[model samples]
Target: LPATVTIDQPAVLTASAAGDDVTCYNAANGTITVSSPTGGSGEFEFRINGGTWQEGLVFSNLAPDTYTIDIRDKNNPLCIVTLPETVTIDQPAVLSASAAGDDVTCFNAANGKITVSSPTGGSGEYEFRINGGTWQEGLVFSNLAPDTYTIDIRDKNTPACIVTLPGTVTIDQPAVLSASAAGDDVTCYNAANGKITVSSPTGGSGEYEFRINGGT
Candidate 1:
């Protein structure tokens, strides 16, 4: 006898026939299509990932992962079988990271922060690192010393996807100061204050009494 097939709504493979006489296969890539001795007129219920049942159809758009198919005999409900099938849905997501300024300079200080973002919507988790250090989530940094650093980012998946970027920070030195003085009774002096003021009528470039102060 021709084995009959029946499926519930949502179109999942609920149950099918067992014995060697009954056979089924996914006719298309990323889909599950089942056929039996029973004709098309036989209604079948189908569902995806154990979800609500719906009319059985040839194709469906399911999430990227493994799935199972169940089939049953519409004419003889007593004859039922569950078939296991794996459906691979392709969902390629892209990740990227960048800084507001490609390069920066700090005068005896480290002040540079990078901003990171992902264009893809389904990015589960994100991580970043500096100069191959520990991976950090959110791709952020603070109080970094003056040096060249590399930033790497990755997504949280079976096979993690990673991306790297290069950046630099330079430190500068402070300014210097000089002073001089002259006369028979003239006295050279250095001030503890930040500013140095001189009161002299002879403004010539000669070896005169001199003093220095106000800087480290």
Candidate 2:
């Protein structure tokens, strides 16, 4: 005599997720990589988008895209595991800009200045360029005229990501004002007998003020 009876079958569910793409433009650090959510029958829950179902499977920060990964089997809630394949996290406008300079205190100065130092990544309301010209939200590039300069920065909410500090702002002047003069000629009408003399006044930085025709 032999007799036995037992048969139970309900175990086959698979769902997967893997994504990480967000290094700029609205960077929220994007990340998602669910670990265990396979096979049906009792205790298993992880949520995203619809929210609230935490069992933790790594899904941090996450911004700039679409995502939906819900797996439920708390004890057969229809034993769902729908993740057909659709999880994107993308952001690429890439931007990183920098520039700083202030030199030319004399000797042929336009008061030299080049400043635009607050640009990193996209989604910023920043736009400034000099040399390649015209695109200013004003980050100070006043007067400026002395040499090497190429500054460029863009992120007017991602304007094709243009960032170039190339020549790296270098404006210098002050050492080109040497004088040596002497003259004396009288007898026409004696306007102080016309005498002019200025000796050894080299370079330029401070103390040097003299005029003749403009009289001073």
* Candidate 1 residue runs with Cα over 4 Å from true position: 1-88, 101-106, 117-122, 157-159, 166-216
Candidate 1 overall lDDT versus native: 0.47
Tens-digit lDDT string for candidate 1 (91-147): 544455565422223334455455554423225666777777777765457656556
Q: What TM-score does model 2 achieve against the real structure?
A: 0.46
Worst 10 residues of 1 by lDDT: 19-28
In candidate 2, list every pair of residues with a backbone clash: none
- Report the number of the highest-TM-score candidate: 2
Q: Which residue ranges in model 2 land beyond 4 Å of their true spot?
A: 1-28, 33-39, 45-54, 61-82, 96-105, 108-110, 115-121, 127-139, 143-167, 185-210, 213-216
In model 2, state the lDDT of residue 134: 85
Q: Please give, for residues 1-216, the per-residue lDDT of candidate 2 as tens digits.
A: 498887976676666888887656676888988765667774677777777776677888888788888888777766666677778998876676677888888778788898877676666577888888788888888888798888778777556556675556789998988789999887688456777799988777756877878876
- Per-model lDDT: 0.47, 0.77
Please report the candidate that would top lDDT against the real structure: 2
